[model samples]
Target: MGFRHTLRDDKLYFYERRDIMEQRHNYLKKIRQYRREDRPIVYLDETWANSHMAPERLWLDEQGRGGWKRPSGKGQRLIILHAGSETGWTPNADLVFRSKKNSTDYHDEMNSEHFLEWFQKLLVNIQPGSVIVLDNAPYHNSVVEKVPTKSSRKKEMQEWLTRKRIPFSDKDLKKDLFAKIQLSVPNRKLYATNEAAKACGHIVLRSPVAHCELNPIELVWADVKRYLKVHNKTFKLADLEQLVPDAFQSVTPEMWAKHCQHVQEEEERFWEKDGLQEESVEEYIIELGTEDDDDDIEVRDIEFEGEGEDSDGEQDECEPVMDENDRELLRSDAVSDA
Candidate 1:
């Protein structure tokens, strides 16, 4: 059986890698199209940390003998933090609370209760009716298994959100204080809404799978990890605990804006480096055709067979190939065939 599998693997190994790469290229192109049409891309991901003392070891002349010296007392606990952001430079984060505890509680603190509260705050901060993209994590999508005989936490939270419109900012102020209130009750337009909890004038967008490039948070993580490596390489768990906040502080709005500008330049450089033309205003006008030229060209969806080309490790799909001969031939062919 192993021999047969090996034989099959040998046959597979002989196949061109480009064929497999092309599939991925097409997939990414479709996703990019969706994103361009969709506004406010949001990214959600998890980060881990341990409570144990930092491991210490000296570099030895010996080969591969490094070992961990387990520390006595408590190990590290996992905290799940969810963050969302828009293209327009707005961001918000919520730490999940696990209702129940384990040997080491890896869940959020308030679980359902806290999640709703945090979500409400996050939504209100971003403004209502804005689209938010998030990852398909269990915490985001997991349906709380309810006890048939008892009320589930999920049901309770849902009921509360539905009936209650929490006041923004100050709790002491009356709910009817906002000028945009409809009659006595506050306008639904004032608060943010999630995919789970739908309300008036709210849009929630789910992030595309396997497409980290679309998420601005990827840049945030890159900056974060870079900051940690350069600033906190020798730091302990306690040091890290302090370092995290400091590191975040270091990444000010100015720094983030600079990073984003750098990203745009880098993207342009990449295309230029790969001998691909940077997308221009003229190109969009030429490709999509002018809005006034309704009779010149008909706009309709057609199944385009994407031809991908290699650019470093990633496949570049939908690269506009400027071939005058090909364009003329295609036009001529259409005219003759018609």
Candidate 2:
């Protein structure tokens, strides 16, 4: 039996044994529909924390007329984590960043040199031209627009910022606010106009709406937060200043699989209760080239691992092909948001 407190009725409602089983049945059905796909599916999400010690006065107004107006101290840490299929994918692969001070003392949070480096490093390790479904984050949106364009560089194109009365500041333009503004800027389709078209190959496509459900990796984070809550631990901004990979070592593949299985089962039960059919999950596996499956375990291990592989085994079975025009359109993204 389970009991839940309701704010609407101002009373506690109790569920008998049958009620609990029925609720679980519905949840399991939902999970099966979401994770049952042949293509790879992953979920992405973000979390952040401000300075470790939040001043009490900062939360409460001194005048006793109002609540705390601003954060007491300066400092913040932001983290991004991605999870794929319940049984597969690595654990706690998080990208972390730290702020100099409090929320009000804003610095360049997005598109900074550091942010670019972090993204570039991640891209290098990913399968070239693999599809990476992401939300409408500013960093992913303005990559092409921010890149110097041919017309602007050659004085052949109109400086849109100048015509729009927008002052250009390499510094301010690099800030998060600039990204917010760029997201609203009309698509110019500059990827076609830029020289660095290959860069866009790293991003796959955007996920559909109401479809965090479609992302198999989303459950990894749901479990992560739950685990943290049980431990009663608060993250400190200073902790993020260190190499993030080390800090995240505590999250192992075994732990992630455990959580993934739990979430998958729970969701499946939910869908069944609702009498809904299960949706198939997408697989990331692609026939990137051919290799003899009979190769020794040592050869197979190297290819599967992030280590160097044998020359004969390294060639892709299906290398991505792109024409100049398509490359430009993809780089500029003037036509499609993907």
Candidate 3:
């Protein structure tokens, strides 16, 4: 046996659930198809920054005395929403405003109404027939017409079946009726964002759950945050506000192109990996349950913790690799921003 002792750290686990894998596969396939057709692919996401967002580590002299004295807390926060393509940030699509809550989770500060407003603004600025990539945030997936779940009253479920003409028996039990609903309307729920995109002749494609690396805007957020962490000295709300615009402007079109290319490569990797997995493993079918079923489903925004990490202390194979040229480009961009 060639086993060796290894230390385990608290790393995030990517639960390769059958349903999640299927979603990822289909998403990658559809995205590649759109690219083949030369459709403009736009990545949209939201992130938040606080006044006291500065570098976590700093140079220390022999005497350990080289660090800036920042504020006590993560001062007033700002929620930022934007969209971009390979060409760069969409003009007039940036939306930033002071957050009402100071929670660490940015999703708490966003809602369906606010997101729709910014999405409409983005639609107006971008060309028609563009493909918008979104993540599975609750706000982004707001249901236009909520389907009846197991928790719904029997009457409600019956009424829904009747309205949809699903041909459910009048004497069917609650569970039986729910099963009929699932079978009849497997993918019937319509998202408000999708409807909005359709009205503008644009298409909305959701990045698979827990797959933040698929969206290029996640990298853009990282770039903007890195700029803020390096340049933020005052750690004051007003100063942070002024620096925000400069931080975003530092992400040039070339950088956006690199990010998009990196994600495309990642998609290809997943496509290959999935093909191999399917050949080796037995086909898995996940049974669907009613909404009240307490399954271990993780619903989250694009900015999730420990993104692109695997729990087994191994680097994710799908992670984009940054070579020397990429590093130099980033360094030059930072220097120019300074």
lDDT of each: 0.38, 0.37, 0.72
Q: Of models 2 and 3, which has the larger lDDT?
A: 3
Candidate topping lDDT: 3
Backbone clash total for model 2 is: 43
TM-score of candidate 3 relative to the true fold: 0.73
Q: Which stretches of candidate 1 lie over 4 Å from their true place?
A: 1-42, 51-114, 142-197, 229-238, 254-338
TM-scores across all candidates? 0.40, 0.39, 0.73
Number of the candidate with higher lDDT, 1 or 3? 3
Candidate 3 segments whose C-alpha is farther than 4 A from its true place: 1-15, 153-187, 276-338
Candidates 2 and 3, the one with greater TM-score: 3
- The segments of candidate 2 whose C-alpha lies over 4 angstroms from its true place after superposition are 1-39, 50-94, 104-108, 112-116, 146-203, 209-218, 222-236, 239-247, 254-338
Model 1 C-alpha lDDT per residue in residues 243-289, reported as the tens digit of each score: 55554555566655555455446434433443443232210111122
lDDT of 2 by residue, 28-79 (tens): 3433333343323333444433333222332335666653333344335444
Candidate 1 vs candidate 2, TM-score winner: 1
